[model samples]
Target: MTTRTPQELAVPVRGGDLAVTRWPGEGPAVIALHGITGNSLSFGAVAEQLGDIDLYAPDLRGRAHSAGLPAPYGIPAHVEDVLTVLDHLGLRQALLLGHSLGAFTTAVAAARHPDRFPRVVLVDGGLGFPIPGGADIDEVIESVIGPAMRRLRTTFPDADAYRALFREHPAFTAHWGPHIQAYVDRDLTGEPPEIRSSCVLDAIRADGAGPIGDPETLAAIHRPEVRGTMLWAERGVMNEPQGLYDEGRLAAGDLSPDRITTRRVDDTNHYTILFAKDATAAIAEAVRTELKEM
Candidate 1:
């Protein structure tokens, strides 16, 4: 399969607009969704690893290119935005792949619009994280990754700097390659100065950390028509033992196997799972195998 460069797009959604990127090809369409703060570029490696098809990756309303989305960015709203993109593409059904925050949206979309997609892949997200009886989700996310989240405010002087920074991140070091470089290329814009990145901090937090998660939301995800599979990083911030320093992710709670067939990929962390060669191969093979069954 040949990998193509990403093209910019703007699609209308309920709250405002969705910033989208497409890699055109001939075959069944596949909609790839990014996590919090991530844009269409997030799916670069997965798209390359998968079949030759029309790929659609959208930056949800509140993040990346579509940073002006209104408040209260919840699951329902995210599902609606996905629907809007499908409608805009004139596709009644397609494969759905979502990561982190995107996974939550994917589950909600498949649940709400059972006929809209035939297969949905959850990339280590959307599970109901353990929450105290009355604790605040936003506060929790902020406290856990405060420094990293705050760094979102600092824009890179150039793509090289951004790439170098990402390379240094424990998540991207081993995974940085052509696909990642291509993905980061889309975020560059400027005159001769060449400013880097299009992500917005407030928008990401508003959308990802806002709605949080509850049993009701998790239970609400039940899409029989949409074949479901979840891919998780074996060793990462999201799947570690609970403790004072731990992020309190995997330790939160276990998921019902009946809903999603989960798989653990070795030698990958949350961020690298979508890009690393071995990790991408695992995800692609799983998706292909599931689609064939469907």
Candidate 2:
């Protein structure tokens, strides 16, 4: 359909390349990191909401056209990759906006190198999840995000399927109908059937559980300069409200609120919050507020 991020730059990192799209505007640069199984388009709606601001959204390694990134997906590696891109671009500081798994990655980066990013926003994730014992990463995925992933796979045999699928989601039903539709439209290809989706199934699987890395490692990181904020879907299946309530209290004992903030997006769920109009507006406001404050 329409390409909002046209200035695409391929930056090589560790094991693969990141397909980064830069949109120039006044103000400090903003880096948008998509969730697992997602690409730069994940921030499409939110980007528009931010208006005239320098934006950089990257297709993380191994996802979509950014294939062949290093395996064993972990936060440290992903953060380093982003650093390489920043250095290559000569950006001294940036505002990081990450969703789902990408949120966790941004947390690691901000915590590890606070100087790299002065402001950060996590859109539904970073607090981590609670799974059953003896559960492998695959099992966790199947139990949590698999339904949406599979639904996307089956619904998008064509362009209409993507729109139809988003329409069906309880979270995005009343959101940016056109923008979400456009983001999904970008994946369209082939004739006869015209299927779409740039997501790499294997990459989704590999990058699954590694973002959690080690709690001890996360605790040890202290980035005083980084001011962080989180936007969580109230009805998220993964980091359910009750769970985050508990995790937040615990994280507070270790992490400072001045450094991190978490706000719940009401009437939204994990799958739909990013596209939901009101939710996206809230997300944009949160990011803008954080950046302005910083």
Candidate 3:
């Protein structure tokens, strides 16, 4: 692993251009995807630990620098952007790593273009949770990512105020530091005393109606040819006692254990599992170990 510095990039997408953070490395090429409402820096903590691979993380359309990207935002659109990014870089293949909503995107991309991604690493998301019978998918999407959606709609009086919003969040408060600070600052736009998240509410809402628990997501984790590791947090998004998935839930999910190996990251929540130092180190190790195994 080497220094993980942000090298900004802008690649054309459907509606407009998409911004990317290219962290150069001498080893393999890694295309990382951040969670919904999160910018590319979400992988800052973990990328810093892996000094060997070329890491490319994009601000998916409708978030951060890509927020201006137009309508028709959803998993399908995201998949197109990911492929476009690869083509723009002339990368025939690359290792895939995604967090939260990004994880879901990674899975589908890998499934659709296995030749482009031999394997992928999913952190805190990727698997589709079964929606209740007769439940409105829109409402369920709202419940799943409501806080992030709300924050996108919120207005902060100042940059400090914007940072305060995350400071109060249980996931980052305990692990706050420079990297987290960078991540927070990158998500803000507008002027001082009028700051707010860069994420677009419409884009997020459209993606919520995306392939959550859909056949695409399930195929990513259940296909016999699919291979990767799923790093789950012990705690939930709010840092609660239970997380999105547990041993029992995983066992009952009808996953292809032989294909996707699953493990729990102790004392971590959905956010920390990808950004916190220890958790990020674990993620770095997972990527490295798999590289060696492959």
Candidate 4:
């Protein structure tokens, strides 16, 4: 399949302009939301393989170019942003896909606004576990994503220096390429000798407490009006043997397979499931299959 350069645009919202990336395609429009710390380019590799639809992903507020956008930054804020994008584009309804925290965001959005985002494609993160009784939310979140939080605070001298840092990340060690490289580049901001991540510290903190197995999220998957497809990876962010949702966990979590469909992409970790060679191809094909039915 042939790939094309994506176009970037800024959609005005309440706090600031939301940065959006559009990958031209011939099929139905797809609106994708990235992970907590991820920007729109997180879907670049998937877009390369997916050529049948117009794919759009946003640099969610407090991330990448939208980093300048002010507070009110949680799942609700993100849901509002998603709706604004839909309204700005004049889309009554479209395919809604989300990865990582984005998966939860889409779930909440589908549950709250079924009229706008009825179709859902979830990647490796829609399921949320309840925090143990009396657990500290900040501590729990930090434990879950400590390294990323540290990376957000650390400063790099330049782009290559930052790249070297991520190159050492366990998740990308096996197969690092342009997709990973671009993801790294997009995360870096500020001038040389003092470059830092574009993701806002506060936003990450706020959203970390946002969604996970909440009532709204659960409703998104079980609701009759929403059609949901969940894709699971074989490994996790650290390329661990057990992924975020192993078979047992998935079976336990998904009580209603009738409303929500689940599938696995083998030889892929949570991060690679979106961009790695074979993984991306599988994702693209699954998307094509879904669009065909629609």
RMSD of 3: 1.8
For model 3, how does the per-residue alpha-carbon lDDT over 144-165 read when each residue is reduced to its tens digit? 6546666877788899988888
Q: Which has the better TM-score: candidate 2, or candidate 4? A: 4
Each prediction's RMSD over C-alphas, in Å, is: 3.9, 4.0, 1.8, 1.6
| lDDT of model 1 at position 106 | 80
TM-score of each: 0.82, 0.80, 0.94, 0.95
Which tens-of-lDDT digit does each residue in 18-132 have in candidate 4? 9999997777889999998999989999998887689999999999989999998988899999999999989888878899889888888888887888678889987887765
Q: Residues 173-216, candidate 2, lDDT per residue (tens digit)?
A: 65646666756555444443646455656667656655434562
Candidates ranked by lDDT:
4, 3, 1, 2
lDDT of 1 by residue, 1-294 (tens): 447777777887766677888887776687888877567787888777776767899877665577677755666667778888989988778878888778877877777677886678888675654456566655666654333565465666666776676667766666678777766665554433455455555555555543354544565444454457878776554323322112244444444556567777777777777887888888888777656654
Per-residue lDDT of 67 in model 3? 87
Residue 129 error, candidate 4, Å? 0.8
Which portions of model 1 miss their true places by more than 4 Å? 15-17, 133-139, 143-147, 155-159, 185-197, 221-226, 238-259
Question: Worst lDDT window (10 residues) for model 2?
Answer: 237-246
Regions of candidate 4 where Cα sits further than 4 Å from its true position = 212-214
- On TM-score, the stronger of 2 and 3 is 3
Model 4 TM-score, all chains together: 0.95
